[model samples]
Target: MARFEEIGTATIPGDGTRLRLLQRNDEFSIKVAGTTGELMNSRLHGSEDALATLACDRIASQPEARVLIGGLGMGFTLAAALSALPQDARVTVAELVPEVEAWNRGPLGSAAGYPLHDARASVHIGDVAELLREGKGSWDAILLDVDNGPEGMTRKENNWLYSPAGISAAQRSLSSDGVLAYWSAGPEHAFTERLRRAGLSVEPVTVRALRPGKGARHVIWLAW
Candidate 1:
C-alpha cells in the first residue's frame, strides 16, 4: 500500500479553518486540519461527476445555456458539466477557497482533466451564495457541492444554502425552466422537504462515491 504524503495546506477564508492536502501515489485527498475523514478524494468522485451530468443533461440543448457551479472540489463537477454542455454554453464556477482554485490549476488538476482551462468555463473566487443572491435568472442550471451537504457539515456558514431563503435564492438565480442540483455525503430528508416547501419539485438521487457498484452511496437532490 502506498502511504499518504502531506503535500500542501490552505486556510479557509471566514473562520480561518485549515485544510490539508495529501497524496497517495496517484490519489489525492483534502481534509480539514483536525478532522477524521477527507472532504474530497480524487479517486472517489462519482457523485461529484453526477452532480454536474444530471443537471447539465437537462439543459444541454438549450441555446447558449448558462450554468453556475458551486464548490470546485478537484474540478470534477466542472469537468463533468463542461463535457455535457453545448459548445456555446457558458459555465461559471464559484469556489470560496482561493487555495482550492490554485490547487485545481496545479498538478492536482490531472485528476479531473483541468476543466478550468476550458473555453466556456469561468472561475469566481467568492462564496456561491453571493452569486445566487446577486445573479437573478443568470443560470440555466445551478449545481452545488459545497461543504458536507445540509447536516452536521464542518462549515456552519454553508447552512444558508440549504435554508428556506437559500432555496428561494437558488430558484431565483435560475431561469424559469432551469434545474438546481445539490451534492451531499448522504441524504437529508429535511433539506429535501425544504426544497419541496419552496415549491420546487425535488428528486433525491443516490450515487456511488466510486465507480458503479463499488463504493458508498452519496445523494444528489435535483430540483426545478
Candidate 2:
C-alpha cells in the first residue's frame, strides 16, 4: 500500500478545527481532524462536478447568468461550472475556511485546472449563509457542497444551512428560474421534505463518486 504523506495543515477560522492536506503519489485529499474525517478526495469528484453540471445545464441558455457556489472543495464544482457556463456568466464561491481557498490555489489547483484564476469565477472567504442572506434574487443558480451534507461535520453552525430558515434564505437568493443544488454523501429524506415544504420543487439525483461509474454513491438535490 502506498503511504499517504501530510503536505500541509490549516486551522479552520472561527472554530479552530484543523484541516489536513494529504497526498499519495498523484492523488490528494482533504481531511478534517476530529470531525467528518476525509472531506474530499481529488480522485473521487464525479458527484461534485455533477452538482454543478446538473444545475448549470438547466440554465445554460440564459445569457449572463450568475452562479453562487458554496464550498470550494478541490475546485471540482467550480471547474465544472466554468466549463458549462458561457463567457458572460459569473460564478461566486463562498468558502467558510480561508485555508481551503489557499489550498485550492496551491496544492489542489492543478488537480482542478486552477479554476480560481478563471475570469468568470470569484471566491469569497466567508460563510455561504451570509452571502445567501445578503443577495436577493441575484443568482441564476446556487450549488452547495458545504459540509458532508445538510448536516455539518466541521462546524456546528453549518446545520442552519440545511434548516428551514436556511432554505428560505437560499430561495430568496435565487432568480425566478434559479435552481438550488446540494451535494451529500448519502440520502437525506428529511432535507428533501424541508425543501418541498419551503415551496420549491425537489429533484433527487444519485451519482457515483468517480467518473465513468465507480466509487461510493452520492446524492444531489435540485430545488427550485
Candidate 3:
C-alpha cells in the first residue's frame, strides 16, 4: 500500500484542536481527530467544480453579477467559477476556518496556482452562515460546497446550512432570480424537497470528473 504523507496541519477555528492534511500519491486527504477523509480524492476528483459550474451556468445571463461561494476547499470551485463567469462578475468566498484560509493562501495556492488572485475574487475568513444572514437579495448566485452534503456531514454546525431554516435564509439572501446551488456526494431527495418547500425552483443535475478520460458522477441541486 502507498504510504500517506503528512502535507501540513491547520486548526479549526473555535474548535481548539488541529486537523491533519495528508497526501497519498496524488490524493489529498484530511483527518479530524483519528479518522481520515479525503479532502480531494485524486481518483474521484473534487466536487467543487460541479457546484461552481452549475451556479455560474445559471447566472450567465446577468451582465455584472455577484456570486457567493461557501467553502474554499482546494480552490477547484473557485477556479471553475472564475472561468465560467464574465470578467465583470464579483465573487465573495466565505470560509469558516482561518487556518484553512491560510493554507489556501500559502502552500495550497502554489498547488492550484492561487486562483483567488483573480481580480474578481474576495476571501472572507468567517462562517458562511453568518455571511448569509447579513441581508436579503444580496447575491445573484450562492454556491455551497462546504460539506459532503445535507445527509452526510463533516461538522455539526454545517447541518444548519441544509436545514429548513437554512434554506429559508438562503432564499432571502438571493436576488429575485438568483440561484442557490449545492454539491452533494450523492442524490439527496429530501434536500430537493426542502428547496421546493422554500419556494424556489429546484433542479437536479449530475456531473462527472474522474479518470483522465473517464468521468465521476457529481450531484448538484439548484434552486431559484
Q: Give me the runs in candidate 1 sitting further than 4 Å from their true place.
A: none
Writing each residue's lDDT as its tens digit, candidate 3 over 1-224 gives 89887778877676555677667665566667566555565345445677887789888779889999998877778888998999999999998777667777766665556888899999998889997877578899999988888963567788889998888888889888899999887888888888888878889987775623457666889888
Per-residue accuracy of model 1 over 179-198 as CA lDDT, tens digit each = 99998999889988899999
Report how far off residue 105 is in candidate 1 (Å).
Answer: 0.5
TM-score-wise, the better of 2 and 3 is 2
Q: Rate the local accuracy (lDDT) of all candidates.
A: 0.91, 0.91, 0.79
lDDT of 1 at 176: 83
In candidate 1, list every pair of residues with a backbone clash: none
lDDT of 1: 0.91
